[model samples]
Target: MRKKLASLMAVAAASTLALTACGSDSGAAAGPENGDKKELTVGVFAGWDEGLAVSHLWERILAKKGYDVTLTSADVAPVFSGISTGDFDMAMDVWLPETHATQAEKYGDKIVELGTWTENAKLTVAVNKDADIESLDELAGKADMFGNRIVGIDPGAGLTKAMNDRVIPQYGLEKMDFVTSSTPAMLTELKKATGAGDDILVTLWRPHWAYDAFDIKDLKDPKGTLGDAEHISTYGSLTFKEDFPTLAGWMKDFKIDDEHLFSLENAMFNGADTQEYAPIVDQWISENQEWVDSLTAAKK
Candidate 1:
């Protein structure tokens, strides 16, 4: 998410007032026992399949428990901003201690980090296995091998920022083109290049289906410019715990490993048609009922 400090402060002010109003009526506030305010708005970033999958899974799970869940899509910036301002109840895919460090620091006071569910998250510069280069330090000298361009996703993404701010300069690749586009566009280019056995380099992330869908390898980063491994986390608004204590506790304990996550993502993205993910996720949940049950189990 882009750090819009001014807008964040404005929203923080409004949220403070609303939170104060809620706090004043603590005695009358309803709890999980009474099922009052059984609604939630979850912010999700577009083109983030993991977020989409987890959000939809929660949407379905909460619905089963009689909560009205709304999924709102936007850029990463607004998702964090919305959650900070209480416009959204929570978000499921915050890459922590690194990818979203700026936003987290800017809005840390306004939000609560529920917990990290997916571990070993990473940003990468991936190339077709057939590519000549094996590392980022080698890219500058052989830029033409991959068409003198580095395909990237959303310009606002932390991955893009790292590429432009650190990777390019550190590796002396300032002259090569860095194309900013959507994940789908980058994937399309990747597919085209790999299908024809042509060389291509693209910015990518771990826990993504591309690794399974394509024959690609992450280029080694000798200087560690791309940053260390991260974790995918959940964040809630300041008053979330007070408002939905049970759900908040459940979220804090929620966890998912790469295997299950990849299976879910593959079901959604690698299907014959990518549009019907909710049903696919529903099927996944049905098949994995034990795991889903564990997510909402009573907290000790």
Candidate 2:
């Protein structure tokens, strides 16, 4: 697992190399030295669409406010570490009490909580809506129905850890194989399975574009193994508030429900070919002018 995580980090390093022209290479805090917080850096979890969406949205929002925001992409753990060491000023998505619990434990004290923007987050195991099973308890008996396999995301993902340590064993799925790879690979398989009208079991999460893009439903976790819904939050470095007081207040009051978040995700992800999300976010902002403006509105 550590090797796999190291491999992912290697990929991130390569990506960081490519992104040098766009942002700081060392992930350093960059700006004018006179306590001017016009420059900001946000660390984004690679492949996490919700984080990517909100981060880009803020990059657009802050840019309009005359702030130069740099969005840096990395793995989950690195993002948290960057936040702690002040390399990244903020990160938009941190799942609490479960999925990112490990990161929160290690870096919680070193960062500032910027408030939760949404509470519709959760780790889930989903199958096509028409699948015969409705609950995870029924999966073992019907494992063959899903080709006796459970597709999963990154090997080092907390969801995969939960599955390996709790869900599979607690549910008596020792005989079946749980595949772990990248999120895109898992999503590609999901797309293939759904397109072919085949029953497929895959690890997924809520507040994700997949829910809107795929015709699937989360299987019931009657034993509470997968955990209840969690909040999606933003966190910042220790000096974030001191450096960016105005932006800090806006972040404290930030709120976006699942419906609006999903729309932005769909616009940026669902059937979109390019990775450049600024224009898409700009379009979304144009359409949701009232709400977008409210995000940065003058405090009463």
Candidate 3:
């Protein structure tokens, strides 16, 4: 009888331990309703102004709502990969139906798209407004006029890929030198060329603050090689909705037009003396409180 009682007690103890271990494992995977999951990671594609602008905006907004949000910047490819692998909770500037389509195809199954914030994005080969040529077809003949070079953004950018694979071949611009450098480098070239009143060509995009900051125009793409207007979407990790239900709902409802997005971009990038974005984003949010508040209206 004594041996049987000791055996029963040991079995009960083992069962309790097993249940506790299982509970701990389940709790780790549980949602924020448990009140322990507050950290969020947002991925930003480096040198993409729209991404930078919106990411910073959300970081401030989420932080105010008790989330410890962290912004991680990387090149386009890495950002998408990080989102797919759940390393980052979300990415703000994924252009679809054209730009970033490659990344989408590669990781589409592993990630979730919350929604598109803007639909006016497109890749372009922009030239000085006063440049003699008006269309991509005329660019080859007049390539020398703009120094026989095309200033391009990051080499891994979808814009660079489109320019190299489709635009150049379609338009017979093989002779023109396409420079693959950072966006800042391309912008520097743009500023210097425009400042000197020289004709220049560079890869550019819509919804960018550069149009407001510089005197430039996108050359016509008669062949439609650069693709049509794309939607700038917010993408997340596969478990994003479960991990951050509040953010998922807010992001799905989030929409910003060109006018407001450009304003935010200009404030963050154009004419700003410092690289610090926290204060700038805060100021922008304060000025646009009504609209900004609307972003989180569903939260409460």
Best by TM-score: 2
lDDT of 1 by residue, 6-95 (tens): 111122222110011123334323323533366677887665777777887777676666565677766677888999999999988888
Q: Give the TM-score comparing model 3 with the true structure, all chains together.
A: 0.75
Q: Residue 89 in candidate 3 has what lDDT?
A: 84
Q: Stretches of candidate 2 above 4 Å error?
A: 1-10, 13-36
Cα lDDT tens digits for candidate 2, 77-145: 888999999999999888776667788888879998988898877778999999999999999899999
Per-candidate TM-scores read 0.76, 0.82, 0.75
Estimate every model's Cα lDDT from 0 to 1. Answer: 0.76, 0.80, 0.76
Query: Cα deviation in Å at residue 119, candidate 1?
Result: 3.4
Candidate 1 lDDT at 39 equals 69
